[model samples]
Target chain A: MQPTETFFSGFAPHDLWFLGEAALRTLWLSLLAISIGSMIGVVFGWLLSVSRIGGGFVLSPLLDIFRSVPLIIQLVLFYNFAPIIGLRLDAFDAGLIVLIVYTSANVAYVARGGIEAVSQPMRRAARSLGMTYWQDMRYVVWPIGLRAVFPAWVGVALGVMKDSALVSVLGYVELLKASQILITRTQETILILAIAGAFYFALSYPISLYAAHLEDRWNQ
Target chain B: MDYNFHWRPVFKALPDLLQAALLTLEVAAISMILGVLIGLGLSLIRIHMKGPVMWLASIWVELARNTPALLQLFFFGFGLGAFGIHFSPYLIVLMGLTFNNAGYLAENFRGGFGAVPDTQIRAARSLGMTAFQTYTRIVIPQVLRIVYYPMTNQMVWAVLMSSLGMLVGFRELSGETQFFASRTFRIFEYFAVTAVIYYIIVKIILGASRLLAMRLFRY
Candidate 1:
């Protein structure tokens, strides 16, 4: 017990390796979730921004309800409910699905803003050139819309990375969960946590800095 | 076809949930108060200070803002135990919430401060106002008006994130919901009630903030 205790001291080589592995897992999950979620977000956002509420006030209300529910509740629902429907997922898969859906809700908002930022004059110009609505969107609207909202996408991406840690509640072996495990196993809680904190900082800082840079560039 | 909804259990659980809801409100309220003070101080330093102080503030803000609040809670709760700095679970939760909220609030405040036009600052200085007076009397009030919406948004996020306190054994609303779910094996009911309470709290906070903004900043 004494050697085992002494061997697993704070900042030990093996512990550092463990932390590194955890960080990698965290990054992987964040990337996977964000990639899938952002794709869905773009489509949902396009529809949200373009759809006219001619008669279906019902659609808007449903979107409101979906957006209002907490992400954690959504996670728990998918975790438990999916099994009963025979679409069983492991904890990781369930967490990933929850993150994708939850993040898509937010991304859709950003996307809508992005799409709406394109000027009416640009649309008219595209139409005058004999372009159809779909062609105008493909050739003119989307490019400008995406550029205008690039900074917003950066913010949303940072959000996804931070929220990825929440999946640890369901026992996923992400960086935060790994830190919890280390605390129980090695008893060097503070040092390991500090390392975990540094890992998160490493992941998030550059993205935020890049967002700030893009905002400056665009504003100028 | 045989399924029938029952309100009896949900109604019976209300008093317990309400007690826990009180705890949740207490945590969010206290943390937001403290967070605003600390955040304002940090924002001042970030904006007005030079060199090392600004860098230190930036680092602190980045670290707190970037990580998940749950990780911060765990670090403060379990991590501190290793350094012989144990806090009660409630205190740890409060500390984590305050630290996390302060980071975002500082940024919101910094953005607000930026919104204060430079010409006004120059005008105040030209009229023989000290830098401190210019900031307090001329800049901060205007900045507050500009930041009202974003600040409200941050407050809403803070309230929502407070639910994470349950992970560290703090018996806030989410924790109580988990307890009920496990005890009664009525996971769906417990969670449904939790979601409704959260939605109501968020809506109330938003409404109250909007009202306060109108009252305070009405020109």
Candidate 2:
């Protein structure tokens, strides 16, 4: 690529395409992190519910480290530390690893709360009805507990989506990073930022509205 | 993995990093104070006002909550520069954090206000207290008690969110860590210690909050 001569240019039509692609990267990263993280988190949460001694002593504090630190710091630490440990990971891979751990740490707490929200007597009733342990969980606990925790899970998912913007610090060209590029090149900081902010608002607002709607319906 | 670990530079930089950590807490504390004031006004306006003013508060709350904090910091930095209104990196971070905190806290305040039943306000007014007096003497105390825990959480959030200042070139704890880490190329060693410092700061805030809660809530 040749160095361009111009210091500032007008916003051309193609910047929209760049923003779109970057938004997709943000979405894709968040989706991958939330799905994998939630699965691991659910299992961790189950272990917590089933075995108090092991989970409380060992697993809880381990997860707390991820929650307590800022996501930006965690990204920088992992991105830099990976090479030292012989893992030749790229920016995207390293960020995904960190985000997945971060997501699971958050979701594990929410999932544990959801499981415990289902009263012990309700589970006991299911077991007394000749339901196996797995059967009791799959049938009674899953549906009831999910309703109680779905809104909280949605909050975590949205939070992860917004936080995926931090991956840009690692040089993965996500939406926020793309805006920075456009702003520097075009000298149209406000316009490009407004466009980028709109993309985030568009992506986030509707799901939150839907979550609120679901919460209202469930309460009724 | 033949990377040589270096703790010497990190140990030497501990004092600078600790000072930066104090700056982090300072800005966060200032922002929290400003945010709570703005947030309280916003909640009251949303509940009591009408037309364009209410819309303005609603817009602020929605924009702040729906977007990323880093983006919001960028908005205060480069976005305002478009209008020829440039802010120093410190101002940019302070504005961004205050904006974000007020949005979230407004929602919490609104919820707290709702939890205080209308009947008490009516009762206070029926006793010939003025509207302002009713709120100040009766309503606000209850609202404050209800929202105290959420306020503590928001304070911790302010500290965490202020770390974004590094991106905007504010030399807070994370920025200082990044500065030293880059200079020495001891990225892992520098950041590992920085992470522990962040953990300690968060723990202190949580511990202090617990003690305050006990003192305030005791019957």
Candidate 3:
């Protein structure tokens, strides 16, 4: 079908809704990945921070190299290569796992930084009050560290949201992939792609502003 | 685990992969050069321009920063064709990286500019420096020093992100790797080699940047 001269002519109501559904998938995948990623990251990051002084000194450079490779490369590597190594995963599962690792890597760094940002005196003060180690973390170190890393975490969220789009390479029906299907079907490539970009811009713009606000308040 | 490790396919593919690696670096270097020049202009406009012009520049920066680079590439490669403008994959990917890089570098540059106190610019102006003279002789030199590290990071980032060109059929390093992997049916071996190639590329870039930074910024 030849597209009309105008960019907007071909999108039916359901076509718009199709784009909406794709956006929902993007949000779902991003939210799911970030939630799981954060949980795993806390453990890894806590260990990294705790052991940085003497032990577990080895994991830092490993994580750095792991993350340095492009997300696309990692996604393709994990998705295509895992099954042959006795780790079988379908496209969606593969995408999810790799993205979790991707997001978790960033979160791990943030978590480590957050942990280190907690003051030594504060830890001692909590311990002097007869609080256990867990209590000290729950009360003092956790709150301060979490607060210090809030802005950085938001930045990671934005990064994860964008990175999730790369999972489309594995044939996941996320926003970018869905937009490709629609563009082909309707011959409205420009409109569909613009819509997809707008969806992402919508998600990220407000969060960025909020992150900026948090940074400003923190600086104050 | 029943997998057999085969290094032969990877070794056989080395020459093509290395050549493709060179292509990847070329694209990244060109995009970064373009990004820096355009980013400098964008930063200037964002900071100095007013009204709709400023708003437009800001929206460009924000959208590029926020969207996935993959989608951004598709927008150019496929989306422009709907408007009767078709670009080759190489051009599309280049535009994508350049646009995204410009947005990020613009913000970095803006921050660098903010770090320089107004007193310095005023001092230059009072010393008979024109606006252009003040910027060329004083402001930009200092801002360049402050922003050099971030610029290196962005350069490395461009190299990595250009891997997305594979999706658009641009035969950069990853694209070539994908091609070889599919043909050989040796997915693991092929990607593992590509991963190592990528690692080496990244290390070389980081090392080179550090050495360059040391030479350029001695106290």
Best by lDDT: 2
Task: Report the C-alpha lDDT of model 3 over B49-93, residue by residue, as the tens digit.
Answer: 899988988988998898888888888888787778988888998
Best by TM-score: 2
- lDDT string for model 2 (B116-149, tens) is 9999999999999999999999999899899998
Between prediction 2 and prediction 3, which has the larger lDDT?
2
Q: With candidate 2 superimposed using the best TM-score fit, by how many Å does residue B202's alpha carbon deviate from the native?
A: 0.5
iRMS for all predictions?
Answer: 2.6, 0.7, 1.2
- Per-residue alpha-carbon lDDT of model 1 for A111-156, expressed as tens digits? 8888789988989999999999999989888888888888889887
How do all the candidates rank in terms of lDDT, highest first?
A: 2, 3, 1
Q: What lDDT score is found at residue A136 in candidate 2?
A: 93
* Candidate number with the higher lDDT (1 or 3): 3
* Residue B132 lDDT, candidate 1, scale 0-100: 92
Question: lDDT of all the models against the reference?
Answer: 0.81, 0.92, 0.87
lDDT of 3 at A219: 76
TM-score of chain B of 2: 0.98
The per-residue C-alpha lDDT of model 1 at residue A182 equals: 78
Model 3 chain B is weakest, by summed lDDT over 10 consecutive residues, at B74-83
lDDT of 1 at A113: 85
